[model samples]
Target: MTTMTRAELGALGEQLAVDHLTGQGWAILARNWRCRYGELDVIATDPGTRTVVFVEVKTRSGDGFGGLAYAVPPEKVRRLRRLAGAWLVGQQSHWDEVRLDVIGVRIGRCRIPEITHLQGVG
Candidate 1:
């Protein structure tokens, strides 16, 4: 088997997250949605709940740093909120519940990646 490099692994983690969200019945609205404030990795809509989810993807190969979720700070959340608003405007989405979700992808040593979904990071 071909060992995935850093970038490839990171990309795989992100794609897995998108697919995971899709499996959860979320309609993917945008990927890498950007604004002046910051970028939202994935913007998905839950038609059943009428909610918009702004996703931040954090991929890690090891616990070298604190943790993957640590990358998403409060300021980052604020920035994501702004970008989420812009996305909403573009999509004309009137959502009752706007949430921030952090997907932490942990690549263990010779193991399948693990996904942790933390909602309302703010």
Candidate 2:
């Protein structure tokens, strides 16, 4: 099997993350949202909790990187938090709560992508 390019892998990972979240009843608000601060991979609302979630998606192949979880370091989480706040400020809608989530995807040659979702991270 041919190896997937990094961009392709990332797109696939994000799609997987979105699929997983939606399957769990989350409504997707945005994807690849960008601002001067940074970009949010996915933004969604959890009907059950009436919360708005900002998601960070990290994609990796094999173990070249530390791991999927390691992709989101403390600094990255901090940045995501700031971006989330900025995103909220631009919107007129209000949510009961704001939450952060990280989704990691691991793809191997010809294998199904492995997805891990870490909710309420930041």
Candidate 3:
């Protein structure tokens, strides 16, 4: 089997994350949304709670860089918060609550990739 590049892996992870979220009954608002600061990987609303979630997707082939636990550092969380704020400012709709989440996708080990979703990370 051929190996996937970093970009390919990331794209696949993001798509898998989107599929996972949608499967959980969440409505996707935006994807790969960017601003001056950085990009927000995924923005979706939790249908049950009516909350907006900003998700950061980390993809890896194996347990590297300290695995999923260390995938999103404090600085990264701050950056995600800034990006989320920037995104929220341009919107007319308002959410009662906003949350930061990290989704870690581990591929190439099993037939199906493993997805770990950490909610309210920041």
- lDDT of prediction 1: 0.82
Q: Write the per-residue lDDT of candidate 3 for residues 56-77, one digit (tens) a residue.
A: 9999888778867688889998
lDDT of each: 0.82, 0.88, 0.93
Q: For model 1, how does the per-residue alpha-carbon lDDT over 1-122 read when each residue is reduced to its tens digit?
A: 67689878778888989988998888998887777766688888876787888888887877778975678888887888788777777775478899988998887675677888998887
Task: Kindly report which residue stretches of model 1 are placed more than 4 angstroms away from their true locations once superposed.
Answer: 1-6
Give the count of colliding residue pairs in each prediction. Answer: 0, 0, 0
Q: Model 1, poorest ten-residue lDDT window?
A: 84-93
Each prediction's TM-score versus the true structure: 0.84, 0.91, 0.97
Pick by lDDT: 2 or 3, better one: 3
Pick the TM-score winner.
Answer: 3
Over the stretch 1-122, how does candidate 2's per-residue lDDT look in tens digits? Answer: 67778898899889999998999999999999999988999999987997999989888877687755677889999999999998899898999999988888877764677888888887
Residue 101 accuracy (lDDT) in model 2? 86
Could you give me the TM-score of model 3 versus the true structure? 0.97
Error of 2 at 53 (Å): 0.6
